[model samples]
Target: MNPILEIQQLTHTYSAGTPFQRTAVEGVDLSVMPGECVGIIGHTGSGKSTLIQHFNGLLKPTSGHVLVDGRDIWAKGSDIRAVRFRVGLVFQYPEYQLFEETVAQDIAFGPKNMGLAADEVARRVRDASAVVGLDESLLSQSPFALSGGQKRRAAIAGVMAMEPDVLVLDEPSAGLDPRGRQEMMAMLGRYRQQRGATVILVSHSMEEIAANVDRVIVMNQSKVFMDGAPREVFSHVAELEAVGLDVPQSARIAALLRDRGLAVGEDVYTVAALARRLLALKGGGGVC
Candidate 1:
């Protein structure tokens, strides 16, 4: 299968030709396949945010190409606006970007901008709201009146309404209560399952990534450090820790158990999975 999004030797530098010149992303290459879920983990300055901004042309590459469906987004006469619509980006604190008078108006903004008719736009707003777990009654109220979590969901609904082929979210669960964060992840899972769209998430939480993503990409020193399945990437505890990144808690605990001869495999990255392995070991009277 072809990649829905591709980054080739991508680089982005801030304040070029000035005293403050610095490259946030340097010589990075990546590909995101259709209907796949990817998680990226990095420290504060690992260039994760800068790299994702190029996915939808929010920022142009300084020296490389970003392609969507085999077409260069930066090519002459390329429809960047179309790219934005296809690869919808929900930035961090997207709620702060909402300015429409009502929730429904805010959610309808993207599809309406896409030139869809009123009926289709309304349908999208309805469906998107339902997907994000927003109440139909709240649609009539002002966005500013909603709670933080509600506003977050409404803002996400706006982007989801566009029905993008690829969904790129930065910290979709940031600053939410545990229940709210769980609901947000559940919403994303349902959206991907229902639409078969490629989803890319940049998150700080290793546990969330371990449980949710099919592929994990670890960034370090403004470059791609590791890329693999969650279990594979997190298994490199020493390398990840060397770069000031932490493996998932379950993986760390599993590693500790393995050191004492529990025979717990490296595939364990979740508490439930680790517990099952331990239970099976005890059941069969394997060396603990």
Candidate 2:
């Protein structure tokens, strides 16, 4: 299958040719397949945010190209706005962007802008609200009146209302409580399942990536550092650490056990997998 999104030798330089100029991303090549959940992980200033902005033409590349379904998004006469509609981006702390008088109105903004009929927009609003677990009764309430978590959901529903083919969320669970974070991730999972959309999650948490993504892309010093499945990426714990990124706790524990002579696989990054391995060892009288 063709990739839903592709980046080729992409580079973005801020304030080009000026003393304040800096390259946020350089020579980055990546691709996202249809219906795949990919995670982008890196420390602050590692260019994760800059990289994702180029996905939907939110930022024009200083060089190279971004392609959506094999067509260069920046090609002459190409409609970048159309690309944006196909690749919905939910920014970090998205709740802060909510401004409509009512929750439903906020969620309807995207669809309405698409020239959709009012009824269709309303239907999308309802569907998106349900997908994000927003209460019907709250649709009429002011967005500011909702609690933090509800506001976040409403904001996300706004993007989901567009029903993009690819959803790009930057720190979707950032600043939420543990339960809130879990629910947010679960909601995203359900959205992907229901829509069969490609998901690109940008986050700082290895645990989040380990638990949610099908593949991982690690960025360091404004370039692609590693790209692989979770097990493959997290197995190189030392290399990840050297780039100021942490592996999941379970993977770290597995590494510690291996150092102490326990026969555990280095790729065990999830809690469930780690627990199963320990139980198997205990059953074999290797360790309890």
Number of backbone collisions per candidate? 0, 0
Q: What are the runs in model 1 whose C-alpha is more than 4 Å off?
A: none
lDDT of 2 at 227: 98
Model 1: how far residue 211 lies from native, Å: 0.3
Q: Cα lDDT of all candidates, in order?
A: 0.94, 0.94
* Per-residue C-alpha lDDT of model 1 across residues 56-149, encoded as one tens digit per residue: 9999999999999999999999999999999999999999999999999999999999999999999999999999999999999999999999
Error of 1 at 239 (Å): 0.4
Q: What TM-score would every model get versus the actual structure? A: 0.98, 0.98
List runs of model 2 lying over 4 Å from the truth: none
Clash pairs, candidate 2, are none
